[model samples]
Target: MLTYYPGKTFLHRLDPTLKVLFAFTISTACFVFANIFVLLGILLFEFLLALSCGLWKWGLRSILGLLKLCALLFVIQILTYGDGDVLLRLYGDWVITFEGAEIGLILTLRITASALPLALMLRVTKPTALANSLYRYLHIPYKYAFAFGMAMRFIPIFAEEMAEIMEAQTARGVELDTRSFFKKIRLLMPLCVPLLLSSVRKIETATISAELRGFGLRKRK
Candidate 1:
């Protein structure tokens, strides 16, 4: 959803090369720092950064798409991580420990911190600008820089294709919605097959379009 928002804010005016470096630096730091307090500060800093760039609302809203997956991941971490004091007892040999819960929260924060700034950068920077900046500032091959831009452009396209596929299946009364989470997961499994085929078709179409446009043959100047 954050596929170039087009604003004249400070971040939008900043050079794409610097923006890429900033995002990479912050995203990488989320993984490198092991302390929960540091992670929280990173997330807090991201929120401030978003506010400063005039992208607080849109940036946060865009990240909502990852919530479901993040929630699942958080749950998995809590279930698997067994250490520290026992916080709760669910059944025989199954308990939620303080360490597990802490770890889960830490991981969830890390992911959120990592994605927030990158998403804001996407909202501010255009793909063409990114490609140009990479080639000029980093001396990356023109084709590879262009490919990176195209890859960013493809994200929302892929998500759109996925939604359309789901809608099409729903029209056929596939009972894709279920109250049970695991049942919903099973229902989504069928969508992957169609999504993969659709992805291949789209990639093929994109390849043909790129070839016709002389994607790799274009000059830097």
Candidate 2:
């Protein structure tokens, strides 16, 4: 499924440079503030922006994915270097410090709070528009920017293809998850071989077609 949703919301109407700057400003502010209230306000702002853009569902999905990363960092922080007064004394001398836990919680919250607005901007904007904006306002090289834009457009297709490959393998009784870690990785060899071979052939065909069409004979203005 495509992660992007096309819409005519205010966010979509805004200049891509401004939208990018807006996300960067919020992210920077979130990193600078240690106060949880300020961070919460940032989160609220992100939610409001997403809602206003009419991408509430898409934004929520992105937020949920972000939450997973936040949870991982929280767990790692709680488990390591937990110092100061013990909140709950677990087995052994391990102690979950109030300061450490508080810092961890704030860090995790800041991460999710910061990620939402960026995700909203990316989800609402088209890659071509974003690249064109960068080339215009940011003075990025047009060829490089367009290539990056094309790469971004291919991400969803690659993800979908991966999912289909996994499902097809599962249907064919490939034990993808039941093997040892190394074995599971080795099993990927079969998948990668075919995908790489097909990709190489496709790339060759595309290159030949472009050469015949005189793609680079004249520099594009």
Candidate 3:
């Protein structure tokens, strides 16, 4: 699970605001430095941080997905932003240029470095603690802080619901994993109906519960 895991790790013990500041600092640094080596170092640091927090598996999964995105970005960047010496020839006049590849690699590294810290922070920090920290330290409105926490908590719940829906569909002979792109897309269409209905039901229930609890009745002091 990518959600918070109760643990005795250093990251788990850190102040929520401090962790948020650290993530912001690292993300800013990633954008500031265009050097590939610096970005690689930051990337390595993120992996090490994940390992220290016992979230290496989740981090690895995120990295794998990002890598595929980076590969596609590399192609797009090379084709659209191609300049300087040609690196590789494609069909006809198309070619991958050195400048394009360089820019693509840098952008990919920057994105990875920027995202991993926040992901790790959220995975380690409980949403309630985060909300409390925002309310206490940052003096944010209680309703907004609580809403942020609830939103974070719902992410994994929705993912689990979607997984269950997929499994049920698979058992009923829906071929969601088909190689044909359009066929797979067509198969996924049925999933939207159930997901949308469930989402609407959840929203309604939440709204009613919030009203009963007087969510916005009293303003934060």
Candidate 4:
């Protein structure tokens, strides 16, 4: 789950606005530089920084958790990049090539490089602090800031719920393991309705609570 870790690490101590800016800057750099080496360097730099902050455990877990997604992207690249030195043939008229593989690797690295910084930041920074920083420093409307904060807080909550749901499904003999990402998605789609209903119920409860706490009165002051 991508949630804040309570610690006095450098990233934790850094201003929330600065952390947001730093994450965006790194993410932007990842997209701007298409070179695999640069992407690797950026990723390595992020890991080292996370390690220094004692948050590499969470960062690595988040990154490794996404390897399947990266593999899917790599597969897409191999299938679509029709022209290059033929590397391997999987079937009739479908093949892998050196350039395709290279491009796929770069595409994979690009996405990973873009995502890790933001994920690491979320781990080290509190959602409330971030929202407040956005309001206090940037003068964003209170409601928008509150929405952002609540979204950050709930992302991990829903992720945990989904994990539990998947576990429950597995216990019931739902074969969740599959080589094809699309097949995995198809298998899991049935649970989405329940998850969505749960999310709506939570949102309704939050709305009631917010109303009781004078949610929109903050803008008056």
lDDT of 1: 0.83
Residue-level lDDT of model 4, residues 1-221, one tens digit each, is 57788899778999999998999999999889988899889988988988977877866876776666799889999988878899999888888999999999988988888999888888888999999999988888978998899999899889988888988898898888667867889999998887898999998999899989988876535
Candidate 3 C-alpha lDDT tens digits along 1-221: 55887898999999998999999999999999999999999998999998898878878888777777788787788788757899898878788888988999998888888988888889889999999998899998888898899889888988888888888898888987568978977888879889889978987898789889877787656
TM-score winner:
3
| Per-prediction TM-score | 0.80, 0.83, 0.91, 0.85
Rank ordering of all candidates by TM-score, starting from the highest: 3, 4, 2, 1
Off by over 4 Å in 1: 62-68, 89-95, 177-181, 192-194, 218-221
lDDT of 2 by residue, 90-192 (tens): 7788877887788888988889988777777777889889998998899887767766676677768667766677778978988876658677777777897
Model 4, C-alpha of 104: deviation from truth (Å): 1.3
So what's the TM-score on candidate 1?
Answer: 0.80
lDDT of every model, 2 decimals: 0.83, 0.79, 0.87, 0.87
CA RMSD (A), model 2: 3.3
Residue 14 lDDT in candidate 3: 98
Q: Model 4, 85: alpha-carbon shift in Å?
A: 3.8
Determine which window of 10 residues in candidate 1 has minimal summed lDDT: 59-68
